[model samples]
Target: MRGNIIVRIEHDCQDLPPERRSDLVTRRLRFLSDAEILDLASRRERQYPGRNLHPVSITLPADVLERLQRLQGSRWSVSALIDRILTDSGKA
Candidate 1:
């Protein structure tokens, strides 16, 4: 089976002058060819294996996130730090 192609556009043109913004709207944008799209999709599928790992999102206060990042420093990842804390507390 084949998957559908989805395109997303992200830009920071809000600060541009009205004339430039209009020009940007009328400008031609490049898109990936079908082969390129399929290749990228296949590569990403192989890059991320979705078997044992689950994804979770949590929002923390700015100060807390800053503290976490400081703790992460060079050796640990945010996930590793959180996992270690949970494991030590008998929560994980």
Candidate 2:
């Protein structure tokens, strides 16, 4: 199996516009080769054994997170809450 493709950077260096304040923000993008892309995909298959790949990002509700934090205070902490729940469930 192969990993993600490795693209080469090839560009004739040039100066950016004066209006662009940050050098970091002003950057050029290079194209990736097909073979390199295939190699990368193959490598990924090997690295992640028997795993179905899926990309994901989650945004939680602010109030819910705040409530969770409130419950996670000094004495009755997050870990404690988890332990208590698990123990009460007779799983631990």
Top model number, TM-score: 1
lDDT per model, in order?
0.32, 0.26
> What number of clashing residue pairs does each candidate have, in the order they appear?
0, 8
**lDDT against true structure, model 2:** 0.26
Residue 72 lDDT (model 2): 30
lDDT of 2 by residue, 46-73 (tens): 3546554322111223432343344433
lDDT of 1: 0.32
lDDT of each residue in 27-87, candidate 1, tens digit only: 2111334343233222112344543432333334343434443432343344433333333
Estimate TM-scores for all models. Answer: 0.36, 0.26
- Displacement of residue 42 (Cα, Å) in model 1 is 32
* Candidate 1 stretches greater than 4 Å from native: 1-51, 71-74
State the weakest 10-residue window (summed lDDT) of model 1.
1-10
lDDT for 24 (candidate 1): 27
